[model samples]
Target: MIPFRFLHAADLHLDSRFAGLSQLPQAIRSYLRESTFAALGRLVGVAIEEKVDFVVISGDVYDVSDASLQGQLRFYEALKELGAHGIHVYLIHGNHDPLDGPRLQMELPEHVTVFGAGEPGQAVACRRSDSREVAVISGISYPTAKVTENTALLFNRKPGSTLFHIALLHGNVDGDLQHETYSPCSRKDLIGRGFDYWALGHIHKRSILHENPVIVYPGNIQGRSVKETGPKGCYVVEVNEEGYAQLRFRELDSVRWQVREIPIEGLADEAEWTRAVEQAVEDIREELPQLMSVVRFRLTGRGNVHRILSEKGAAADLLTELQRRETVRAERSEYAGLVWTEGFSVETGLSIDRERLLQEDSFLGEMLRLSRHSGQSAEGLDDLLSAALKPLMENRELRRLLAGAGEEEKLGWLTSAAELGITLLSGVEDEGGAAGPMFSNGAAAARHEREAEE
Candidate 1:
């Protein structure tokens, strides 16, 4: 069998703006602005370095509003680089870049072939070393932004001319609740086609629906928001003599996004808390030492630091100090990589000695016991606990917060009643203690019980 390799990528979303951010340092902002283009350049670098036979981009090459002249020129330049290396390029437009969408009118390089929107098309790629057909790639683009048809069903089976076949698609297969159901289809439809591999796009998370025939989603090359966290890149695929394919994920993202929850338990003072946060940033930098990172941190767990952190504007102050340190680190560092906190949130409670509180033998102790008992066995405490929490849940402000919260999230908030109780009783003037008045009505004991049920 002739050895052949290809790079599979999707959802470039070039020139797309990063959401949920503002007032960032100029250096970080500059990096974020060029991250998508840099990721594409890295993909082209991979194609040249691996000397792959071809590259397949599933869809969404650019944002709907960003088909500017510069965007088109940058995309063309990348393709020209690949064509110069004798690597073939195959692509299909997705919902964001439909056939009729606004775009810069330009011609791609001779080696680049884009499938049609109205119908599926085939492109046979031949190995440069052997001059023989190595793979048959079939694909179709979206004609409009909303295509509810089962587009995968339109894909024909592998032709008799090539042993290795790949289906490049941009649709929601088996539906993901987080995304729209465009060109939706089931896994059965793809498996039935007997294609060697399915290159998928649109859902921004990498997934492998099957291994027997190698179906894959390479995800987006760059993450543009907090929701899109961790490493984002593409897959390099190689076929063996027996027709078995091996896939390996490559890191092409110039900037990475991460959300970390750090427990503040056992931390006694603000200094300790800051040290812990610094350590987390160091750990993240070590993990992705080559790429710059934008991180959001949530301080959790119960401790004395909770009181300090719960003060008004405490989180914002911490973020300011963190950003200052980030600037200093960047200036002092000799390396190219840098890391900074995008935002900080405090979700901690007051440290409460639950065992000691339980042994009080007073009304509060009895309430705590009842809360624990209700959780263990819903036998008798469900109604009692619900009644106790009713006033809090009915509060105009608290109700608003819990209005969209699911049962699990409600349970989590309810279970933190002990810490809230301790803070309120101490009159710490803390944010978490603000909920203390509602719990003072003896209804707070239901927190533990609610947790057990959850």
Candidate 2:
């Protein structure tokens, strides 16, 4: 038998947040802020329950640049518990918790081993009484925040014949667009070193790059935002006597954040919209324990509802109302609690008068053409447009004007301009011409109406 069973975990972005949790209700805000520590405790609990030979935290134990002494002490206490059980704990500093800093003043337990920031080195862990000898455990810690050079060069040495070689690292493997390319390396760099398994971290999403050498990122122990969705947890690796390894993901997160998009194509009334929103929440609730998850509901699809839902006050109010509901509040809110928001847009049940509008030869049409072209090069045009159009879309007077405009008056102005945008975007003519009442079209019309109203 392999005689060694271990849990591999990384990227515990402890005490982190998703931009604006403070603005939510106190109950939810408090939960969101405290969930990180809760997840960390869960990790230690799993380690004890499994009775593994050792536990390896690849990197990023906490998120704070200057983590509190209390937080560090809490973590030390957890490790100490494992130490008491005669289970050794191994760790390395990731990008978030680089070696250089205002260090937390705490003495680690005897059974704990933290990799240093110097040249690549190995830590030998063994059980003499059982005649069990695990080969060289090699690892390197992040010395600074931005490590650009290849750090794999440090761990080029192979292990002796009598031991199982395991290497731990905290850096981007290759071109991971989601993360900065710190200490970049490749599968070849790791496998070439003749290591048995490469315990890696940095990316927050769990993935297995290579199985032969057992390269893995256990992801974050808990999710922190809508971006980090689905089942958040760690991995358990069991290495057999012949060096063959089997990996299984173990769920450890207390509160998971999920993003779900609900279509509104045929929702005819307020009841239907409410039901749809409820359904989205229910789906998430069904998939996860209500009391342990927060969901971000994104309203998608084409229809008049898009206009109503996209309005800043209406949208914000809807989210607030959803947050206040008992079913949502009690179950599906974030540890901080739940707050819904609109997501990506798809065309709704609205049409434009492309032919008649394109016939116009006016300054507005030329301006539209300019907007279309300039929008291409504009880096943050979407944000700028959204900000500029808020007042117009919300104004009752502006909506009435938009809803009642004639072909010659309204269609001619907007169609020509829309074509310019189409040309810039697709290098083609505006196939969907002068759309119906701006409010009925979708977010673009509502946005434009808001701008006009302003």
**Candidate 1 stretches greater than 4 Å from native:** 328-335, 354-433, 436-454
Error of 1 at 275 (Å): 1.8
Please provide, for model 1 over 169-250, each residue's C-alpha lDDT reduced to its tens digit, 9 standing for 90 to 100: 9999877645678989988889998798999999888889899788899999998876688889999998988888899899
Model 1 compared with the native: what TM-score?
Answer: 0.81
Off by over 4 Å in 2: 64-66, 127-131, 310-313, 326-454
Top TM-score hit: 1
- For candidate 2, the lDDT comes to 0.66
Best by lDDT: 1
In candidate 2, what are the lDDT values of residues 1-454, reduced to their tens digit? 3456788889876665544343565666666666677777877787778767788888888755647665677787778777777778788988888887556766787788889887766777664236376656788888877778888778855533656778889988866645677989987888888777899999888999998888888898877655677777878777778878889888877677666667777887556877887777666656664436656555554455644554433545566566667436545543333333322222232323444444457654555554545455434344434455567878885665544444344343444345434334332322245232222234532453333222
Estimate every model's Cα lDDT from 0 to 1: 0.78, 0.66
What lDDT does model 1 reach?
0.78
